[model samples]
Target: MTQIIRSLDEIAPNYDVLFCDLWGCLHNGVAAFPAAVAALQDFRAQGGRVVLLTNAPRPQQYVAAQLDRMGVPRDAWDAIVSSGDAAQDAMFAGAVGRRVWAIAQPKDEGFFTDIPEEWRDAPPITRVPLDEAEGIVCCGLFDDLTEVPEDYRGRLMLARERGLTLLCANPDVVVDMGEKRLYCAGALAELYEDLGGTSLYFGKPHPPIYDLARRRLGLDDNARILAIGDGIATDIAGAAGEGLDALFITGGLAFDQFGPDVENPDPARLAEWLALRAQDPAYSIGRLR
Candidate 1:
């Protein structure tokens, strides 16, 4: 492994493309991190392509709009790719008799607004209600686990036995929803798979999302690309799997062992964690302004 001894100051000169994860890295899904936004701007000013790769189960456009509204400079990213776009692609151009009972919060349904006209007029995609459906497309798990009626589980299994394909838009088990830890669709989809059903996953730690990340940059020519994210399981693992340098952010979505995370931990904690486990990241500590 080639260790680069990186800090935010040295990130851009060191890499040609930077693949960053949204939600945890740049924003808390509700606001943008000023320093995080500045880092991308600095990288772009230095001639690097910035691609924000996210597990958000919405199309790239939606991600861009959200960032734009949050004061994230539009040019901070050269392009964006998301798990939602991948799932939409997997739908095979809206074939007849195909339906997806969307199991997610209402706000995220906007991602499906661009569905084809041929699909249907009953909202193209209906909420994945706890009953019969042709197939399931999970955007997120319902927040209250205890309130998840048994009827919901039955329908999932029934659909699976009938050979329905359960497509997962976002694959994270949970994301820090402000101060509350809300469940994501990935958790429910995993449970379904455990019951002998197969699932199509979109997002980081999955192949398609990374492929999109590379494509957006037209990556090649020894153009070093760095993937920066806040999670070990998704961003770091996904970037490493795709043979890209990874910069892990320790100051975002993740919570400490007890209570809520009131403050963000710094990059030194990332180095300490890696060193304690005899692991190493190409860079260490905060690199962005």
Candidate 2:
């Protein structure tokens, strides 16, 4: 049974490390949550390490820059492991062909150009038109603010016909960007699979990202780890797959299902919802606090 808790302090001593999600738990795209920030800071002060594990589809440096821009202080967490970092490793290793088609926004262009020092000897990757590409690299939608997955059905169909494998950078289908929900790279990847195309994911709920996170954590396998996030499919599911305890944040994506009080989730409703989904997180909280 999952226990609904009031704050992280109640259970902090049980775990030595935290694999925290970024989007809904720590920040809401626009700004960092003060309570969530403080909770993580407090965890570190107690000698517990915090790793910001995210499916942001950008390298850790860029994600760190984004956090800086979003007012998420550096002291709140110890390290960051991003899906982009994992996917980039695969891409540079030629998991997909050298000449590929890129589906991303201007902000995501850094994913292609900012090759880490480690990948310097790897084959050069060039972005070509869909018709001329050997594989597809999906960082995100070209315009997440104004586009949806269906917008690329025709193009995806052509790629399917060619048997091109799509490398999905982010495996989050949707995210609440403040008050607006936006489609992500995973949405397009899902659509591609639905249309008889192949899509590869290197994000949450996938083994590759988790493997990379463990390495970044630099902890022994025996270290007690907890995963805290609002994404049921990505963060929570990923934690479950990795045999890590999960702290489900109800206030992030599924706030409405827990009744009108966002800070105090309805226990019965939360129980029923988790039962319906067959997810038994170790603990549940309205927010990170």
Candidate 3:
């Protein structure tokens, strides 16, 4: 059945916990969506718990600080959990004292600096390497992991033969990057798994990250949660899979990929779009602002 909501107020009475999406649903990376911010603020004032759930590949604290700068008040929500947090947790899990091979941008290497000194930071290649490491942790893609070539298969296979565990910081296959659709880390990780390498992913649309939010927010399974986001694959699919209602914000993540604007999305197209992924978020909202 189809569902619709005209205003944020309509959501409060139906939900005790709100698992809102960032980016398009709340604001563009550079600016905050005013309507979204107000809605969240109203939710908290009514004694509801608001947990900001995002697929961002950065830590939750960093995301919070960035949002704060964009005008999201500290009181806007109860807590947050980002894909990056899960990546960090997985990176530290047994990986703290062990060696790891990473394929990420220069800026992203810091995520691994916290690893124990005893382990090694195996030399990085856009593709796999000849030398072995205890595990592999991926953050961003080189040439965008989404567009990797057939040749890289051999490199991934080499890592697998060595039996190294693989880590994917961003579990997105692709994302709406303002102007273009770019590949994400999960694409390469999937290939590695197909190559016989073991891979672990941390990000949206995944049950683990959602599970973490469940504990932090103290939200019961029966709680009516509204998850709003831009990406149908991660935000909508993940939340729906977890038995929560969701709102699809058109222009946030895949704004450019789908059409002209994410802020004002075409609901008919969106509904059909998400149906392919089996994602049926409760409503299709224009945007936060």
Candidate 4:
């Protein structure tokens, strides 16, 4: 049974840190949620560390820059841990091999160029044509706004024939960008796996990203950490997998399932929805605030 709470302050004191999601919880991909930002600020004012644990397929620095553009103030979070950072580590270490085919947008070039300080001495990774590649690196769709997973079926089929392992940067199937829903790298990976291709995931709902977040926190294993997000399969599932408390924001991906009102969720409807998904978050809120 999960409890429906009004605000984060109700449970803020119980947690030493928060591993918050970016896309849907803190913002709608266009602007920062004023209440969400304020809640995190208040949490930090009380000495709790807030780490924006996002599944964005780019390094923390790039994500941070995007947050800056979205008006997510610096005081709201202590750090950021992204899927790209984790996948980049595996990539440079030859997890996807040295020569690979990249499925990403022009904005995602930083995934290769911006090497973290510690990884500067790592082996070089080069991007080549699909026919000459040993693996596939899927940062995201070349154009998320206009593309769907099915659009890449032909290319993925070719990669599968070659037995290329796809390294998925973000394991989110879909994310709401303001009023529009966009396909992410995970959607392509899911399609690839359906096509009998091997896909490696490093984001939420997987241990790699959580491990990176824990490393960033630098806290004892027993430290109280709350994971906040709206993605049922990615955020809530990841929190459950990590044995951490989760705060589910109903207004993101599954906003309509909780009844007519977006802010005020119908308890029974919320319960039934969660039950259907087999997810038992510690707390549920209409929004992150």
Alpha-carbon lDDT, every model: 0.69, 0.94, 0.72, 0.93
Worst 10 residues of 4 by lDDT: 115-124
Which pairs, if any, clash in model 3? 24-252, 251-262
The CA-based lDDT of model 2 is what?
Answer: 0.94
> Over the full model, what C-alpha lDDT does candidate 1 score relative to the true structure?
0.69
- What would the TM-scores of all predictions be? 0.80, 0.99, 0.80, 0.98
**What tens digits encode model 3's per-residue C-alpha lDDT throughout 4-97?**
4556786678888888877557765567767888888988899888888876676777688788788888888889987877777766655422
| Clash tally, candidates in order | 2, 0, 2, 0
lDDT of 1 by residue, 177-201 (tens): 5666666777777778877887788
Evaluation by lDDT, superior candidate among 3 and 4 = 4
lDDT of 4 by residue, 146-216 (tens): 99999999999999998899999999999988899999999999999999999999999899999988888
Error of 1 at 165 (Å): 2.2
- Put down candidate 2 lDDT per residue, 71-111, tens digits, no spaces: 88999999999999999989998888999999988888888
Model 2 per-residue lDDT at 126: 97
C-alpha root-mean-square deviation, each candidate: 4.5, 0.8, 4.7, 0.9
Clashing pairs in 1: 8-287, 140-185
Local error of candidate 1 at 146, Å? 9.1
By lDDT: ranked, best first: 2, 4, 3, 1
